[model samples]
Target chain A: MTVKFNNRDPVYVQVIQHFKEQIAKGYFEPGQEIPSRRELANQLKINPNTAQRAYKEMGEQGLIFTEGNMPSCITKDEAVLKSVREELIIEAVDLFLGSIKSIDVPLSEVLEIVKKKHDAESGEAEGSK
Target chain B: MIEVKNVEKKYGKKRVLKGLSFTAEKGEITCLIGINGVGKTTIMKAIMALTPINSGEILIDGEKIRKESFEKITFIPDTITMLPQMKICEAFAFMADFYKNWDSKRADELLQFFKLDSTERIANLSKGNMAKVNMILGLALNVDYLLMDEPFSGIDIFSREQIAEVFTSHLIEDRGVIITTHEISDIEHLIDRAVLIDNGEVLKEFSVEEVREKEGKSVVDVMREVYRG
Candidate 1:
């Protein structure tokens, strides 16, 4: 739940992004209960008002839901969950491509290096496990 | 809301606050940020009526501050106000005697929250512990508004962090907090609004998130523009 928030972005926006990343990474399961606004504020060391704003925004975006007098939970909608993961992948790709483009690397060359590095990293993970 | 409308104050030959004005609303943490001797504390004292204002007015909930206002608002100075020889419990007792709105239960809760032993004398506590005790005394009061002067100043990182957590926790729930600080890095995310002052006048008064959202500027960025621009 630790997020080193950048000061330029709105805190509530960062909070939403953190939740999106957690959901995409499967760290937060679909329909899993989330901390209340006050609890989240205390945990994140942010203002409670900011936390409430985040929750309200998340609710409007359908990233989370709340029942009557119940705590908020991650969206149980499978399509939305899948889109969250896809959105993160696209964002990472966009960032990588943006930086790689500046280096003038060919698409084929970049793909080869990425595949090699990713495979090696996964192999190392498997070996360690 | 606590409103300071064109408040002016002078110290004998020196005028510290010149037409300083700002409003701190209930359930928001408003920070008064400026360099030293910019009348941040003076503005707070004027709000509390600890120092008489030469002109203009200070109001709590639309009414000028009076004797009854003391019960509705509490001031936590940078240093502990209790006697050095007094034990923490004794200080609590003194507060209970002086302030009718003092809540002993909340005091005990805050004591545990800070992990302080009430039997220890104020003279024996560390600087951080003394600050914690000072915060406890003010927070334990059933007040709607709190004015704190540099609650994070001159403290270790961990102690400052603990005090910052108090701003988020239920201890500060629903109360308007006005804290003066030259340092804004520690609790930038915890404060709702920032009132930047320079030479006893408000240079900028804006919501932290609003500025971040609209202009992509952090509080420090705004401060840089206001103070150094």
Candidate 2:
């Protein structure tokens, strides 16, 4: 798929975040073979060293693993998969709350609006199906 | 590593580079960024020994630049260095005859990658195509370092896109690349380090990732602080 990176954060960090997002969305199934470091660098137009760093960091975080000379693959650990899902949800909620905290709207109104929007999106997904 | 230590240069009575020093490491892309008339091109020329520096030293892998060093580093100037009358194929032949490191297979691959025709005359090619040919000639060489002077400058958007695509390809990997450009956005994500220059002096040298992590700033943001402030 498509990953759009912002200019603010370090690219390697963003790359890790992109993989996490993909995994959380069930796009990258557990044990799926990911692109090699060179392939990742070419696809993202980043330096190979940066891609290597991203993969290294991902490995450290248990988001991916490598065996011998084989290419890196998504983590098959259920604990890591659960944590990744929780991490993304927490990040999304933190962002949502941080943004709404500065506004004049009440929490109840914001929750109602979010609920309506969520239902609308769910309805659209079902309609498409 | 390509190191320029305390480089000083002058044009007639005017001093251009005043104690300029920077190191571009192997396996990384170091960008030399500054406004016009700030000696960006002069630094590239000095590195190539095209214009002799008034003082200081430039070392390639810890030795002074010499004829042998020429085989290890390739410099692609902004303008056409080849004879304007020569076609793309003839230019390739000329390079092959001169440089022992020239790789005909790599040149052929780059020619196809840039979608350049070998029979097309250099003089008749558009500015973008000329830039591509210039890049192809340099990249076809098996060199440890590549110095590019304004590869993205004065080119069409489509040509710039094509050139940007080449940066990600395997063609230029694992080489120390020193690129001087005012248009930083074209290769912003691709560069590993940024050396900001102002009035012949290096204002700052920082890794792009360091700036992004510690200061939450891009190279352009850093440039604004150094140049505008």
Strongest candidate by DockQ: 1
The regions of model 1 sitting more than 4 angstroms off are none
lDDT of 2 by residue, B1-229 (tens): 9889999999999999999999999989999999898999999999989999999999989998888988999999999889999999999999999999999999999888889999999999999999999999999999999999999999999999889878777877898999999999888888999999999999999999989999999888888998888
Residue A76 lDDT in candidate 1: 97
Q: In TM-score terms, which candidate is top?
A: 1
DockQ for every model comes to: 0.90, 0.73
* lDDT top scorer: 1
| Pairs with backbone N, CA or C atoms under 3 Å apart (clashes), candidate 2 | none
lDDT of 1 by residue, B6-117 (tens): 9889899798998988999999999999999999988888888888999998889999888898999999999999999999999999999999999999999999989999
lDDT of 2 at A79: 96
* Residue B149 in model 1: lDDT: 99
lDDT of 2 at B36: 93
* Reference contact recovery of candidate 2: 0.62
lDDT tens per residue, model 1, A1-129: 778999999999999999999998889999999999999999998999999999999999899999999999999999999998898899989999899989998899999999999999999999999
Total residue pair clashes for candidate 2? 0
lDDT of 2 by residue, A1-129 (tens): 446777779999999999999999999999999998889988887778889899999999999999999989999999999999999999999998898888879988998999999999999999999
